[model samples]
Structures are given as C-alpha cells and as structure tokens.
Target chain A: MARVVVDVMLKPEILDPQGQAVQRALPRLGFEGVSDVRQGKRFELEVDGPVDDAALARIHELAESFLANTVIENFTVKVEEEKAEAGE
Target chain B: MARVVVDVMLKPEILDPQGQAVQRALPRLGFEGVSDVRQGKRFELEVDGPVDDAALARIHELAESFLANTVIENFTVKVEEEKAEAGE
Candidate 1:
C-alpha cells in the first residue's frame, strides 16, 4: 500500500473567516505570543496499490470537485511510499 | 517579509472525526473515486522581517500552546524564502 497527503488552503486573496476566528481566539486562549492563525485542511489516504501519477491526478480532480471549495480554497496533493515495519 | 507554513495532523492511529464527516459526504458530493478523507490544519504567516529558525521555534511553541491539540495532533513547520517581484 501507499500513502497520499492532500492539503487544502485558501487562495492568498481570499478571506478565511475560520482562520480569522482562530486568529482572534489565539490571544484569548492564553497564547499571547501568537499574532494570527489561518486554518486549512489536510487529508491522508492509504491506497490499496501503488501510488502513481495517475492516482495523484485522480486525487486532484476529486479534491477540486468535492473535497475543496474552489471559491476560496486551493489544493496540493502528494504521494509517498509507505514503509511497513516488521516484527509486531 | 517572509512566509512560514505550518501543518497539523492527527497521529497515524488517531481518529479524525472531521475527516470522517467529509469522507462520508464525498459520495453525496458527487465524487465517486474518493475512498476516505482525513482533515488537518495549514497555516501561512507573513513576518515583519527575515525568516529565521528562532522565529520558527516561537511559532512552534505558539502552535503547540494554542493552535493544535497535542493530545491527538502533531505539527510540522516549514520556512520558505519568499521572493519579491520588482517593477510592480
């Protein structure tokens, strides 16, 4: 099996209310050292087979179509070779 | 100014409730190829000065102190050299 990591975030020009809320809450949350907080999304996937470019393309399409709100958020997809440790 | 990106994610064994919700909604959202979705967090920051390791360490502490629930999630912070375009 392989692993894929997808990240979703708002375009630079987009205002993120969720991120804004988190940013505003930081200081009140007893974290005075913080200035801003921007919220985004991460997705982890374990595929049944090898992670190839085609699989990545499909994932990108899936993200664009449903996983992300293109009106504000854009996505980045990455695939990794999953290594399994023996001796459980 | 410089930019910093932070990513927060659940440990491999941790259950991601928000990700699960999005995963369930995928098929209904007209995405048939999606199998599962796990949600995490991304943050982008523009600093007043150069990007440095000390600044990153402070950001890490901030994230741990308030931005993320360490009980379930871990954070990775990256500093990128943001370039400026002249003649704008």
Candidate 2:
C-alpha cells in the first residue's frame, strides 16, 4: 500500500486564532524567541494498493472537495514512503 | 527567518474518530479505494531569525510539551525550506 499525505492549511490571508493563541501562550510557557505559529490539519491516507496518477488525481479531488474548505483553506497532496526502522 | 513543521498525530493504538468519519464519508462522497485515513495536526512555525540547533531543540521541546498530547499522540518535527514560487 502507498501512503498519501494531505496537508491542509488556512489561506495566508485568513486569520488563524488557534495559531495566535499558541503564539501567545508560548511566552507564558517559557518558550521565547518564537513567532508566527500557524496551525493546520494533516491527513495520512493509506491507499489500498500502489498509488498511480489516477489515484493521485482522485486524492487531490477529494482533498479539494472534502478535506479542505476551499473558501478559506488550501491543501497539498503528496505520496510518502514509509521510513525504515533504525538498523533495518 | 526559517520555517519549521511539526506534525502531531494520535498513536496507532489510539482511536481517531475524525479520521474514521472522513473515511466513512468518502464512499458517500463517491471517492473510494482508500482506507486507514488518519487525521492529525500540522503546525507551521515561522521563526524570527535563522534556525539553529538551539532553536531546533527549543522547538522540539515546545512540540513535545505543548503541541502534542503525549498521553495518546506522537509528533515529529522537521525544518522546511519555503518552496520558491513558479518562475521565481
């Protein structure tokens, strides 16, 4: 099976309150010298079999229609290979 | 400035209702041929300056303590170079 990753984030022009909250809380948590924290969603999809171009296109379509709110968010889809364990 | 990405996801043993909901809805939406849809969070951090090892360590600490719920979720962090725009 091929693994597909979809990263969905709000448009740059859109405001992200959750991100702002994290930024604000960082100083209180003693994590200083950081800024601009933007939070988003990531979806890891395990395809039933090998991922082909057709499958990728369908995944993109799904991302556009279901995985992201196009009005405010944008998404990118990519195929990923599982990392081998250490010493494997 | 540099960009860092932190991907946080529930452990394999943890139940992901949001992911399951999407998987169930996909067939209804006519997008099939997919399984094991796991949903997670992605944090895009914009550092004020260059990212060094000290900065990276701090980011990792922040991710472990604030960004991820160690009780059930696991997270990974990586540095990302901004993709140049087309024709740039």
Q: Write the per-residue lDDT of candidate 1 for residues B8-75, one digit (tens) a residue.
A: 77766888788888778766766545566667777766555655677777777776776667887777
lDDT of 2 by residue, B1-88 (tens): 7888899988889999999999999999998888889999999998878798999989988998899988888888888888421100
TM-score of predicted structure 1: 0.74
Distance from true location, Cα of B34 in model 2, Å: 0.6
RMSD of each: 5.7, 3.2
The DockQ leader among the candidates is 2
Model 1 residue runs over 4 Å out of place are A24-37, A82-88, B23-36, B82-88
lDDT (Cα, 0-100) at A54 in candidate 2: 89
Chain B TM (all candidates): 0.75, 0.90
Residue A49, candidate 2: C-alpha displacement in angstroms: 1.6
Worst 10 residues of 1 chain B by lDDT: B79-88
For model 2 chain B, give the 10-residue run with minimal summed lDDT.
Answer: B79-88
Give the CAPRI class of candidate 2: medium
